[model samples]
Target: MLSPSPNSIKKAFSRVALVGKYQADGMQEHLGDLAKLLGQQGCEIFIEASTAAHLSLTAYPTKKIETFAGAIDLAVVLGGDGTMLGIGRQLAGSQVPLVGINMGRLGYMTDIPIQSVQTILPQIIAGEYEADTRTLLAAVVLRNGEEINRSLALNDVVVNRSGISGMVGLAVKVNGSFMYNLRSDGLIISTPTGSTAYALSAGGPILHPRVAGILLAPIAPHSLSNRPIVLPQDIMVSIEVVDGREIIVNFDMQSQTHLQTGDTIQVRQSEKTITLLHPRAHSDYKTLREKLHWNEYPSTF
Candidate 1:
């Protein structure tokens, strides 16, 4: 197990906000237990408003998602990666660090297990943890030189066919230079933090968080040779809709908008980043092995 670095911050996370996936089973019980634990540790807890609506957490103080900025020092997110991702976006520019307790399958970001929270969380609270800062991809949709929509993604920005009717033809450009064009089901532009998510399923490489690159992976391209590539994080990638109907673009598969044939989507690295606090022993390779079951050997036939 990796130990907490000697330079770990000391008692820096006191004011904490607790956010959870409201629809999860036993949410009330879990939230209550967690809130009580934080109080005992001499920490102030603020519950996110939406989560309070779903559960009877009336005894504790509640805060809206928008009010989290500048109000809290840390956020303890309880749920899967989806929960973490949602909260991460809201707290992105605020730089309020987040710690995740896993409550769902395949937790790449929500690394701490529920059973271990009682044991591990306190260590983190007491200044024994590691911190990881992840970058975001900011994208804008433009049509006829007019900006239409804009959003930020901690995972990826995808351009895809909206329905089963046809494939989308997209022309790729990097820093104003043309790259290539292809007709495919979709294309995924991912950050290093997202290389393990949908991009991994689409045959993209696993990019270490320390790598200064962005990943581009074609989803089921018509040509088998169209492969995934990592581009310099400093460049802007422009994808123009060359053809096809019912095309769309989405931010981390959460927010989406329809596309016109002449529209262009511009994506680039954002100046904002989200800070993630992990148990001092957290290691990326160890996490991959445990989550992907990399150590499991197959039975001989």
Candidate 2:
């Protein structure tokens, strides 16, 4: 979590960034409306140059993803989690607070509704929201002792077979300690913030955001006895491509590259974190029960 400094309130914003799914379903017209609304309130809207070109809007001038970090106070992402993820990569090291507006279904991260942006924009500009700092995982893929790809993830780092019918073997280690060898579709190394995502589908536990740990779960493990394991946040988890003629490494929704045998990936807690702005009263448990349709085993009634 981000600690409020004495100057925190003074750091309240007048300039904001507008981000949305490029070519999102039914959002193009609304984007222009949102920009007009925010502009009416004296907020400067900074957008990606590509998005600007895509929309062909003249009033809402834009900046490149690289320059957006230094130019805005906060980023309002109008779409689902994937849109937020794309923006997160651009703002990763900068520690910019991202407010997600849900324009899609099953939005675990993007919580705000389109109709509420105008109502909530003022409060957010006034620093009336709480910030949840979600830790990220950094991964480096190496082949033949050469670094092939490096990326950071707000969700999970996955290694699996690429369209192959056969299961892949992944060797795992935590803090230099041997964990297990697994024959599965893939492996997921996720933070507590991502437990509700693909990890949950693999039988991993849903973790509270404040929890300082990581979840390692196997995707469709051949051995039914294999289960998700939680580990201390400080430990480094390593996965090696043990076998398979073809494999792939993925960070969140983006796939990095195809991997040959003898490739290894090192995953650890990233030094930088993503700051997510939430309504003051947002509750993780409530979100889960509602969004995930997770019924309480026995109702209190």
Candidate 3:
């Protein structure tokens, strides 16, 4: 479980922003009700522009995410973890706390269910909550020794085969030291916050969100000896695609870019961090047990 820092307690979230999936079922109603609740508590509310358009909500002021940096105090995401991942990358360095309302399957990050929003939201607005900070990965794609693209990920950065069905060769390096060359279908570089995401599906270990480490998990590795490895948070990782293979690099599964044979992708811990606000009752172990259906039955002695 992540403990809240002293500074994060009793934060005055007077201005709040709402971001939700476009046209999701019952999204309009949930967002409307949430806005009303916050408003009744004397908190100013802002709706993300696209969400406002989809819900035809003109009651609250609509603003784009880029404009939320200095103006908004808190961001309330009303979708699943995917929505939070996208928005989390944007708000990583902004120091604006986020609260997630689950509207999608397997809401690891979006823990707050829609049914409990009414009950929990009041406590959160009154500063009865715990805030946990999670790390993010910064990736830079280089072609011919020149940087081409850069992106941030709150979950993971995936380097996988572009179109071919065959395996791709990737040379892994950490802090300029060689690790190993992996020939696999793909590779996943994940943060602790992303341990339960693609990494878990690829046989990576589940890491606590507060753990300061990065995970490198091979996807369908050709050899049994190649296994997932966890590295210290401060090291830099470089993965270069071997010749004659085309690969695609994905950031948080939200954005993608094609990579050439000689292209290199450098991933390191980002200087920014995402702050997640959880209710006082939040427990990572309980969440994991519930989400993964673990230890569901009582053991008989």
Stretches > 4 Å off in candidate 3: 1-11, 104-106, 299-301
lDDT of 1 by residue, 1-301 (tens): 9765433434567788898888899888888999877776677889989898788689889998788888888899999998888888888898689999987565889999888899888788888899998999999999998999999999999999976769989999999999999789999999999999889999999998888999999999999999999999999999999999999999988889899998999999998899999999789999898877886876652
- Candidate 1 TM-score to native: 0.93
Q: 80-115, model 3: which lDDT tens digit per residue?
A: 888899999988899788999986564878899888
Candidate 2: where are CA atoms >4 Å away?
1-11, 295-300
| Clashing residue pairs, backbone N/CA/C < 3 A, model 2 | none
- Which residue pairs in candidate 1 collide? none
TM-score of each: 0.93, 0.91, 0.93
* Model 2 vs. true fold: TM: 0.91
Weakest 10 consecutive residues of candidate 3 by summed lDDT: 3-12
Better of 1 and 2 by lDDT: 1
Alpha-carbon local distance difference test for all models: 0.89, 0.81, 0.89
Q: At residue 152, what lDDT does model 2 achieve? A: 91
| 1-301: candidate 2 lDDT, tens digit per residue | 9855433433366677777787886667878877776666567777767777776766767877777666777888888888887777668878568898986464778888777778876677777788888888999998899998899998889887767558998889887898899999999899887898889998999989889998998999999988998999999998888897677888996757788777889999999887899777877777788787777566874
Name the 10 consecutive residues with the lowest summed lDDT in model 2: 3-12
